[model samples]
Target: MSFKKRGPFVSLQLMSRWKNLVGLNVSIGGFVGKYPHCFEIFTHPFRRNLCCKITQKLKEVIVEEENVIRECEIDAVKRVKKLLLMSKNRVLRVHALRLIRKELGLPEDFRDSVLAKYSLDFKLVDLETLELVDDDDDDDDESLGVAKVEEWREVEYREKWLSEFEMNYAFPINLPTGFKIEKGFREELKNWQRVAYVKPYERKDMSRGVERFEKRVVAIIHELLSLTVEKMVEVERLAHFRKDLGIEVNVREVLLKHPWIFYVSTKGSTQTVFLREAYSKGCLIDPNPVYNVRRKMLELVLLKNRHSKELSRTGDETHEEKSDVVISSHDDWEGERDGDWVLPILMKSD
Candidate 1:
């Protein structure tokens, strides 16, 4: 029986190798399951085309959305013209165009958002560049037809998890003038505030997550301006520590987002120190831990704020490392306001 099975194994090996040569990309598990079936059909060459035919069918299924999106683009171009004319200023025009394209079921690529950020630069002014016109170009030239617009549309149209500001006349309230509330600005605000300030909550409702969500996301962002003062206090602590130990790390590339405090060493390496733990432990001290941590924390709290670029960006790897680190807020799940998602902006300088 063993000798008789040798011929079958050889034929199976040949068929498996042939499948690989044809670039079928099927898994070995499926190939093993189909081995017995392949032997009976070996004499028939046409049966081998099954794998190729299946691969083509899968590709067609994936590409079917492309045609639907092409039609969506044709409709969007007509709508954008009307939207552009109705907008008040360059900033409002960008927001209006984004809303209209979203409403018309057209895509807004990341590039479109970026262009919207600097809409003043790309306006169709009374100029001499006729070559800039391209009929093939859709209004969302930034998406480059990878169907990002379609994906965004799907997210926008979902019954649940609708953007709170969508179709609502409510602008970002409690904001000073010269600032516009753009989509996804909350993400940037949270990151900036996290870097800029650190404060303890006396009451649970006054906690970062609860109070922040109840107010406009921008209000939480403006609160970060206080963080500059926090940084000065942190630097003073670092100065005291270095003076005691007589060692100088200089603490360059410092990113002081409290509760998950981060900084870079003299070697340009990253170090994250939790302020709560560091203060409690001997790692962060001002001659005494129990008596001084509270008084020292409050004494410099009222100082004027100043901006420092030292903690802005470290490097690409440090940013990537941040992603792998889990960052769950102490109060992530409690109910509050809707538009309160925060994310970080990758500044150019490390």
Candidate 2:
């Protein structure tokens, strides 16, 4: 039978409100009435177009609603159907079913579907009644219809697997022996593994762990390689400075071009002769970037000796000469001050 129509104005209004029906069940009376305003508007040809538009929009909403209901019911069905077959633990079964219903957007304070495939119900202590309920389920019977719930569940599981697989990015690594490839990368990997309980999962955990580990490791290794190269540059600079400054008194300069250098230079005369080399070496030392920035701050503390044999000859002569000069100068200066200088005496033994 043809449905009653509404006027163009009313039909347009209804069209505007069509999308709001999402998740709402279309009332039978509302559908049948077509409403007085809607009928008047929809009777005209132009108004009829508005009615059609509204109807199409409502159809889309209906389809989406159906899908949501189907999905939610499917979850409950899987739980209940499984419960029915295993045939025990009524409380758990009911709870699972209730959870599924809630997930499906069904009312929390409501009854199970009145139109459930089976019209059976059971009270506590009625084990026979429960058994009958299970037996009546068409889902378990092969001769009966295939449960759409099972099909939907498989689809859901497949979707989940694909989504998680796409995100998997960890790799297996043997710790202690395998150094990190990135800065702090090893620690991050360890934390992730621990959080995921990867060790207990073994192979499954390793597969993902290793993949993620590889990326982080590669990044770390690159940084370390760069740092090593930078360190070598510093060492070479030091070697060039030492050789140029002529501080090769003891240690051999065999490995002058080596990545690591051993050498020293004086800050005084040595610096002037080997200024360029010294400067280059200083630049390479890069105290700020090194592990211990203060390593270069220490200066030599030299101890002087008063009676060392090496300086004894010069020491005696200087001591005697300085004493004579001090005595003569003191007496002469005093006489001049008193204005009694009687021709500054030049004493000598003829």
Candidate 3:
């Protein structure tokens, strides 16, 4: 998409120069060939060199996603406000927010479009930090302290008729399929779930018990995932907000400890932590417009070969086929591994 803004197409040589920067191990032309549905490789009309441009379908999806994000500015503001409220200092680094902007459904120019437009609600402490502006008219400060998970706990307690002992201070845990439940695992999981800790939005004291501190970290990660559009986030991206959010422990270890509450997937280059309860059969239970559009793009990428074959059959090829470049099959791609993408759980026996 960035290449599209520069011109109709970018030379493969130019793209190859920065392939490592984009984390692509394969040559730029080879990478572009793998996803024919999203990109088209062609001979440059004047330069006579190999070049690539995003396909019309992908361009439309990008525009549609941008439109959807713009339409959801109000909700984005609420998400930002909630994030600010959940932080330990009631302030978040601009760089940290930028890392997870797409996950939070913020627009590309959110600094101007969302935060600056709603200046009364958000304040720029400096060029790099953002803080929420306090509303003096609102006397109910306690209401602001309630985290999103507390609402779920309330629902489990009242509507589902779950006892406080079972639901209170507990997160909704959905263990993955085929998870081996060893003889004392259930009892241990139950005890861990029942362990109380300070909520993500609440204040914390200086007490440093290991169990309490770990549980608090779990809650912080849980709330962070809940705020995302897909109920997942890159583990390294979460580390960017560690100082602002008070996540002092190793983020990946904390995620690995709570198997039921979080699932760490080593599918891509980065490790992503998925909130287990938010997904059913690998699909989000509650997907938003931005997620839907992004999913469409993913679907397009997944069906690249089929789309290319269809275009060939219908005589609808968009680019010339005279080039000597050999596009490899999807299986030849570097990261195309078979079987389940989820990493195996490494549980320690008590």
**lDDT leader:** 3
lDDT tens readout by residue for model 1, 89-137: 2112233233223223344451243333334334433321101223334
What value of lDDT does candidate 2 attain over all alpha carbons? Answer: 0.27
lDDT of 3 at 43: 51
Candidate 2: misplaced stretches above 4 Å?
Answer: 1-55, 67-76, 79-110, 114-350
Q: Which numbered prediction scores highest in TM-score against the true structure?
A: 3
Q: For model 1, give the 10-residue run with minimal summed lDDT.
A: 341-350
Report each candidate's C-alpha RMSD, comma-separated, in the order given. 26.6, 45.1, 8.1
lDDT of 3 by residue, 1-350 (tens): 23223245555665566667655666666666777777676654434455566766777887888899899888788778878887877899998999889889897688878888898889998988999888857554456567768989998877889899888788887887799889999898899888878778776673368898888888888888888887888888899988888888898888887788888888645588888888777678888887788887777767645647544221223542222354333222221122112111111110
Name model 1 segments beyond 4 Å from true. Answer: 1-50, 55-63, 75-350
What is the lDDT, from 0 to 100, of the residue 200 in candidate 2? 12
State the C-alpha lDDT per candidate.
0.27, 0.27, 0.72
What TM-score does model 1 achieve against the real structure?
Answer: 0.17
**Number of the candidate with higher lDDT, 2 or 3:** 3
Score every model by TM-score.
0.17, 0.20, 0.85
Tell me model 3's lDDT, rounded to 2 decimals.
0.72
Q: How well is each residue in 1-350 modelled by candidate 2, as lDDT tens digits?
A: 22322211233323334434322244322332332211111232322222211222233433454455444553334433333332223223234334333222333332435223434532323322222243544544442222222233356557756333322322223332243366887576555433322221122322245434333322222111122212222222222322222222222223221111112233322211111211243443432222121121111001112122232231112111111111111112221123211111111110
For model 2, state the Cα shift of residue 303 in Å. Answer: 90
